[model samples]
Target: MKKSFLILVVLLISGMMSAQNGGNDMKKFESQLPQEGRGNVRVAYQGKAIDQMIYEFMEEQGIPGMTLAIVQAPYIPRIVGYGVTDIEKGNLAAAKTLWPIGPISQGFTAVAIMQLYEKGKLDLNDPIGKYLKEIPEPWKSISILQLMQHSSGIADYREQKAFDVSANYQPEQLVQMVATLPLAFDAGTDVKQSATNFLLLTSIIEKVAKMPYHDFVKKHQIDYLGLKQTYFGEDIPNVKQEDVTTTANVHQTFKKDKDYINPSETTTGYVEKEGKLVVAPTISPTSLKGFADIWASAENVSHWDIGLAGSVLIEKPENRDIIYKPTKLANGKTVPAMAGWQFYNHKGLMDIKGNVSGHSAFLSRFTDASELVCVTLLANKEGVDLTNLGRKIAAAFDSSKMGTGANDDLLYTYESLFSVDETMSKIEKVLKTMGIPVFAKFDHGKNAEEVGLKLRPNQVIVFGSPKVGTALMQENPSISIELPLKISVWEDKNGSVWASFPQMNLMAAEYDMESNPVIGKMQELLEKIVIKAASQY
Candidate 1:
C-alpha cells in the first residue's frame, strides 16, 4: 500500500508540472531528477534540477514533512510537499495543507502597520504614546517606526525562562512580563528581535483601527487578498475542508495521494527529543499575538507575499520599504535586517525564519534579482536552519546569479546532494567528462572498517590536468607535491555531505606564484568540477 501510494503521489506531481510548464518542459524537468522526486520539481530556467537535492536534504535533516513554494515574481511555478505530515496518523503533507509559519507572521503584522500609515490613520514617525496610553513612558517615547523596525530595544517576553508557550497569556500580561526589564539597548540605538515590540504594535493597531488586531488584519490583508488558507494560531482547529483552498487550484503534489484525508488540519509539528522525533507541545495563540501566531499553507504564504510586493497590500513602495529595508540605528549605522528579516549579499534578497513550538518556517524573497524568486519552506521539525537550503533551491532556478557557489560561504566547500560515495562518483564522472585523468581514489570509511575500526562516510578523489600541473610545476617545483588536485567528500555527524578542496589562489600564494595568470584558470576549472559534481545547480 505504501509503495502504491508513493507512486500515485509522483504521478500527481507530474500532472502538476505539466499543468504549469507544458508537457515538454515537464518531461525535461523530470529527466533531470531522481525517481523519488522526478515529478515533484519544476525548474523555470535552464540549470541542473534540484528535486533530488531537496529530497536528500529532507532525509538528512530527519524532517518528517515539508512544503516548498517557489515563486517567480507574478507567478508561482509550483508548491511541492514531501514526507508524511502526521507520522502516527500517516497523513502525507500537501501544498494546501496548513502549517504554522512562525516569525514569518511578523511580516503580516508589519504590513498591517504600514496599511494604517497609508490611510493617514497613523504616522510611522509618531510616538507610540500617541495611540496606546498604558505602555511604560520609556516604551511610549519609542516611535511607531522603531517598533516595526525592531529597533525599539524592547526585551522579548518569550525570552523569559518561566514563560509557558502552552499557557494562554493575554497580550497585556505579556507586555507586563517584560515591563520592568531594562531595554536591550537604547531605543533606535541597535536592532534586536523583541516580541514585545510587535505586541505593543498590535495594541496600537487596535487603538488606531478601533477593532481587534486579528480582525483588522483579516479585513484588510487576508480577506482582501482572498487568502482562504491563512489563520490565527487558535483558529486552525476550526478550519474546514471547504475553507481550505490551494492557491492556484492546480497543486496535486500530495493531496490526491493523501486521498484528501483530514483536509483541513494543520500539519503535525515535531521536535527532536532524546535524538528522536516527537510531537511538540502546542503554543498559545494569545502569547504569539502580533509576532508569530499566523498559520497558512506554503502556497498561500506565497500569494500574500506577492500581494506585499505590489500595491495590492501596502499600496506604496515606500511604505513597504519601511518594513523590508534595513533599520537605521541612532549611531548612524544601519542593521543588516529589520523586523524578522535578514538581508543577504544577493541583491534584494532577504529572508525571515524562526521556530514556533515544534514547527520551523522559512520565507525568502529574492526581490531584486533579474527575475524575482521567492522560496517558502514550512516544516514540522523545529530549529532546522532553512536559509542555505532555501537559497540553494532558489539558485536552482537562477544558477548564474544565485548559484550555491556564489551565495554560500567563502570557503571552497560544496554541499553534496548525495551520499559521500555518490558524491565521489559524481566527481569522478565530471573528471572523466572533462578528460582530466584521475590518478587515485581512497575510501577512508571503508579502509577503517576493513581494519576493524569505525569511521563515518568519507572519501577522497585525486584528479587533475597534467598540462596545467606541469605549467604550475615549472613555476615552482614545490607546487608539484600539491598537483593532481584532490577533493575530500565526507558526511558530517549531522548527515550533511560536503566536498572540500584547497583554494587554488591561496595555494598559488603559498608557492609565491600569485602573479601567475594560469593560476586563475586552474582555480576556475577546479570550481567548475566540484560544482558539477556536488551541486544540482
Candidate 2:
C-alpha cells in the first residue's frame, strides 16, 4: 500500500512538470510574436498558429520536406521544419537537415569576390585577361564587374548541355569549354543569367585568392559566418544518412503508382525493365565547382543572412551594399538585377532564388533601413515556385509591399480577352497602326514544337518607334538594352491568355533617368497598345 502511494506521488510530479514545460514553450512562442502594429504580423500568423498553415501548404504542394527560417532584425530567428525527410524511413525534417542550395551558391561566391575587392586584391574594372592569360579575344576584354552583372555576354554552357550528369571537369577545362562558344552580345551591352559568368568569376576568385574555390568559401563564408550546418560539396563530415534531406525524385521511372518513392530509400529500386522495377542508378550532384553545389540547412542560411545584415562577415556596410547594388552601365542606365541578387525598388527588398535538378531554394532580405526581416526557405522538390512561396510567408510580417511580392522585375501583367496568338496579332496590328517598327516577332512555342518539345502558347513581339527610342537612348545609350521593346503574350496554367511587360516608369526609376516628356509619352503609348490588344473584340 505504501509503495503504491509513492508511485502515485511520482506520477503527479511528472504530470506537473510536463504542464510547466508546455507553458514555457508557449511563452517562448509568444515572445517571438510581433508586437501589434509594429511588424504588422497578420492576424492569421499570430501566436503559434502559423505552423498549421505551413503544414497545410506542404500537403497541398506535395512537398516531402521543407525547412523555413524567418528573422526579424535583432531578435533571434524562428526556424522550423515541416513534413518528412524520407518517406520510407519516416525521418522527420528538422531545422538542421542539410539540403542542396543549388545556384544560390552564387551569392556566396559573389560575397567572396567582394571580400577580395575589399582587400584591394582586384579591381572591378580589371579585364579578365589581367587575372588569367589565354582567355581569348572578346572574353579577355570582359571586366570583373561585367561578369558579376552577367553582362559579360558569354554564352551559357548549360544551354548546349555541355556537361552530363556524371561528367566532371576541372575549373580550367570548364573555362575552355565556355571559350569555345561565341559571345551572346558585346560585353556590357546586355545582361543574361549565365552559369558561365559565375564559372569565370569562380576562376578569378581562385586566382586572386590563391586558394581552392571550395576552401576559400569554407573559410570565408561557412566558417567565418559560424554556419555550423553549412558545407561546400556533396559530403558533410560526420553527418548521418537520416540527418540530411534528400532531393525529390524527379525521374519518371522512380514513381510508384502516382506517388514518388523516396530516392533515399535503398530498398526501392528505380530501374525499369519490361515494366518491372530494378536497381536505379545513383545520381550525384553536378561536378561544377563554385557556381553550384553548396549545401546548408535553412537555419544556417538564415545565419548567413543575419551575418550579411550585421558586420560579421563583410565589415563595411557599404561593401555589403555593393553586393546587391544594380550594375550601372557605361551610359548611366542600370540593370535592376545584380550578380546573384535582384533588387525590388517598389518594396525595397533584395532576394535570390535557385533551382537545380531536384532542389529549390529562396532567400529574401528586406532592405528597409529601419526594419530588417529575412526569409529563407529550402525544399527538396523542384518546380515548387519557392519565390512566390517565400513571398507569401514574408507577407505575414509586412504586407504593404507590391509587385509579385518577389524580386522578379516583371512589373506589369495584363490578361488578354483573346487567345495568345490573337493577342500577339492584335499587339502587332496596334504597333503597325502607331507607325512603330516591328524589329522582330519570335514564335517561341513554334520553335519548341520544331524541336519536338511541347510548350504552352507563347510569343514575343518586339516593336519600338525610332523617334522615341532614339530620344531615350540619346539621354542614356545604356537604355538601348530596354529598347526595341518587347511584349510577351502567353497562356498561363489555367488556360488564360495574358500580356506582360515591365513597367516603363519603374524602368525609368531603376535607370535613374529624369522623367522627360518622351518618357511620359512612351509610357502612355505602351499602355494604350496593351489596352487595345487586351480589349474585347
Candidate 3:
C-alpha cells in the first residue's frame, strides 16, 4: 500500500506540473498576439517582425496546419508555416508543405487557355464547338471566353444531388452527367460558376496541346518557373538534394540562410466530426480534373503568381488583361467577378478562394498598389473562408494600401467570433485597456423592447480619444457631427455576430480634410481595436 501510494502521488504531481506548463505556454502565446503595438515574437524573414495574426486565427479556428506566402513587389519576402500538417503524427507545417489549392486551379486553366491564344492556336472569341466535339450543341456555341468567365450557363455537375464527391470520376464522366441537362440560361446571358466549364476547357486544352491537361500546365507554368514543390493532386513533388537547411518546426526565431530548404510532406486534410477533427476521406485527383486538381506549396503558388504578373507566362500584356478583366454578359453589363476571382471595391484588389473537401485556400493580389502585394493562404480545414484574413495580413505589410482602413468601400464590417453581447463586452474591454473612454452604450434590443418593438441583438459603443478627435475637428469642424467614433455590434438574422465601423478615409473625403494626419491614425487605431475584439485570441 505504501509503494502504491508513493507512485500515485508522483503521477499526480507530474500531471499537475504538465497542466501548469501548458497553461503558462498558452499565456505566453496570447501575450504575443497581434495588438496595437509590438510583442516579443520573431519570424524567419529579413528582420521583419511577426504579425501574430495568423497564429491567433489558427488558434481560434482550430486549424491544424497552414502555410502563408507573402509577395512584396518583385520579391517574395516571407514564406512560413504554423501548427502541424499531420495532427496524428504531430508533424510541423513548413513553407514547402503541399496543399490542394482549390479553385485556384481555375486560374491555371485560364492561363493555359491564354497561352494557347497567345500562340495563335486558339482565340478567346472562338466558340467551344471549334475545338470540342463532345460538348452539347448549346454549349458548342458558347465562346471560349464565356466558358472561362462562368458565363456559359452550363449546368454544374458537382451540384447535382446524385453526385458523390468521394467517387473517382473521369473528366468525360463529369461532362456527361450534365450533358443531357438544359443550360441554366442562354449561353452568355448571365454568370454562374460550373465545374463542367473547366472540364470542357481541359478537354480543349488536351486537344490543342496533344497532351494531358496536367502535363500542359506542368510544361508551361510549373517547369518554366522551376517550381519543384508544385504538382498535380496527391502527387507530392520529390526532393533530389540530400542536404538542406531546415527551419525549426515550432514557432521560434529562425536564422537567415541561403541554403535550399528541405521540403515538408503534404498536409493531411481534416474535417470536423462530432466537435472533433478527423482525417477526411481522400479525394480522387481524377474527380477534381481541370477545376481543382492542383496541389502546391504556398511559396510556389505565389511564385507562379509572380510569373503571371509579367510577360513570362502569358507573354502579352493584352492577353493577360483578357483573363483579368471582368466578364460581360450579352446585356452589356460586366460581371464583378471572373475566372473564380472577385473584384473588391478596393482599386486593383482581386482574389480567388474556395474549399476542396477538407482544405481551404485563398490568394489575393493587390495589383494597382504602389507596390504589388500578393498573399496566399492554405489551411487544412474545410469551409473556413480566409479572404478577410488574407487582406488583413497584407495590410500588416503595408497598412496604407490594404485592408478595411484603406478599402475603397464605404464601410467594412468584420464577422465577430463571439455572440453579440460577448462581442460588445470585448469591445468595451478593449476600450478600457487602451485608455479610450466609452461615451455611451446603446442597447438597441433593450430599447426596442421598452418601446414594444422587436429587434435582434443590436448594440453600439461610442468611444474615441478626445486628443485625436480634437486634432481632426480642428481641421474640419463639421467632422464633429460624425466624431466621437462609434462601433456597432449586432447579430444578423443568421445568428452571426458582426462589428461595423466607417472607413475614416472616406469620412475625411466627405468632410474635405483628406490631408489631416489624425484621420490616418484614427483609422489605424479603430482597425486594430475592432480586429482584437472581433477575433478570438
Candidate 4:
C-alpha cells in the first residue's frame, strides 16, 4: 500500500535525517588518496564504515537519499550514494544522481568571464554595454567584477515568491524579471546574493563565448575538469512535484517496518497528498526552464549530465586564477555565518526551503593541515540541504581522532606577496595553518638600479631584525634557525606584482615537528615576532 501511495504522491522533504539508514556513509575514514596517479590526486581505500552511520542517521531522521565524495588522505577519492533517488518508483540513488547544486556555479561564471579576459576579449572593469546591444540602468557604471561579485544592486529572481515556478525559463526572461525590479543598491556599494548577478554572468558568457550559458558551461568548466558527477542542472529532466502539502520520505525518517525505497530524482518543489504526488508550482512558461534539451531518466542517467564544473581547485599557485573574499552580512549580526566554517564555506543554497539559489559553492583548503579541501555546494534553489550535509561532514572530521592530513609536497611552498602568499596558503591549508597575523612592513629604499640591485626589480625593500633575532635565540635555542626574513618584490611575465617571504617553510615545518608543546609555543612566539617586526614609525 505504501509503495503504491509513494508512487502516487510526491514528497516534500526537509533537512532532518535518521542517520541509521545511512550505514557506512557516516563514521571515520582511513584511506589513502594519491592525487598524482589519478591525473588529479591518487590514493588507496580501506574505506571506513561511514555508510552505516550515514544510513542510521538518515533513516532515523528521514533524509531520503544522499551522495558523498571524500578525497581520503594518502589515497584516491571515494564516492558513495545512499538511499533512493526517487521514493515512488523505488529508484535507487547513486553518487551519479543529478541534483541541483546552485549558485556555487557563479564563480565558474566569473572564471568564464576571466577566460575572455585572458583572450583579450574583455576587461575586468569593462561596462556591460560594451558587449550587449542594450544596457539596463546602472549598466554603464557597473563593471564586470561588480556584477560577478554581487556588489551590483541588482535584485534576485527568487526574492519574489512567484518566481519559484518549477518550469524551465528562458535566459532572456530571467533578465527581464531582474530588469522589472529596481536595483537593491548601487553597484559596488552593498552586496546581496542575487540571481540577477549570475543572470548577467550567463548573459555575458553568451555574448562573449557566442554560446548559450549551458553550452558555455560545457565548453569551459565541465570538459576542462572531467567532472562526471557535476552539472548545471538545466539538462536534468525535472520531476514535477505533485503536492505542496503532503509529506513523504523527505529528510524525515519513515516507519521502521515500512520497506519503502528512495528514488534517483526525488520531488523537490511539492509534497505527497494522500499518497499522491502533487506539484504546486506557480504559473509560468515551462520553456523558461531551458530543460527542453534534457530527457534524462533511469535508462540514460549517465547520458545527459549538467555542465558546470566550477568548484574547489585542490592545486595551488593556481597561478593567480582563483579569487575570493569574506564579508559580514549587512544585518550586522556578529554570529558565525554560512561562510564562516573551516574547510567548508558556503554562500548559496538549493535546499528544501529555497532561501538562496543559483550562485556559488565553496570548498576551502585546510590552512593548518596538509592543504586538504572541504566543501558545501550552496545553491539558490529554495529548501535544499546539501550545504548542511557538508557542515556535518566537516564537524565529523574536525572532531574525530581518525582524521589525517594530506601529504602533498607543495604543502611546503613559498610566500612572497599576494601571489606567492596565495600559493603557500593552498599548500598549508589542512596542516592547521595560521593566517598572516603580522603585516609586512615596507621600507622604500633607492631604486634597484640606484642601490646596485643586480636584476630588473619591480621594487625593493630592506627588511631584517637584529633585536628580535637576539631575543628569540635567547628565549629558545631552536628559534635561531628561522630568523632573518626578508621580502623581495617583482613582476611576473603577466605584469602582475608578486611578493616573496621565504620563512613560511621553516615555520610550517616547525608546526609539524612531532612535539605538540613545542609547536604551540613556536606559533605563539612567531605571531608576536611577526607583529613586532612589521611595526612601522
lDDT of each: 0.79, 0.69, 0.78, 0.41
Pick out the ten consecutive residues of candidate 1 with the lowest summed lDDT. 36-45
Q: Which stretches of candidate 4 lie over 4 Å from their true place?
A: 1-49, 56-61, 72-76, 161-164, 229-234, 237-322, 327-371, 375-389, 395-537
Q: What's the TM-score of each model vs. the native? A: 0.67, 0.62, 0.66, 0.48
| Candidate 4: Cα lDDT at 120 | 73
lDDT of 2 by residue, 94-191 (tens): 77677777677888888888889989999989999898786777788889988888888897766665665346666566666677778888888777
Expressed as tens digits, the lDDT of each residue in 403-485 for candidate 1 is: 54431323466656567887788888888888889899999999999999999999988887788889888879998888788
Ranking under lDDT, best-scoring first?
Answer: 1, 3, 2, 4
Order by TM-score, highest first: 1, 3, 2, 4
Query: What's the lDDT for candidate 1?
Result: 0.79
Per candidate, the number of residue pairs that clash is 0, 0, 0, 128
Per-residue lDDT of candidate 3, residues 467-514 (tens digit): 888887777788889979999887765455668888887888899888
* Weakest ten-residue segment in model 2 by summed lDDT: 263-272
What are the candidates' C-alpha RMSDs?
16.9, 17.2, 17.5, 19.2
TM-score of 4: 0.48
Please give the TM-score that candidate 1 achieves against the real structure.
0.67
Q: Comparing 2 and 3 by TM-score, which wins?
A: 3
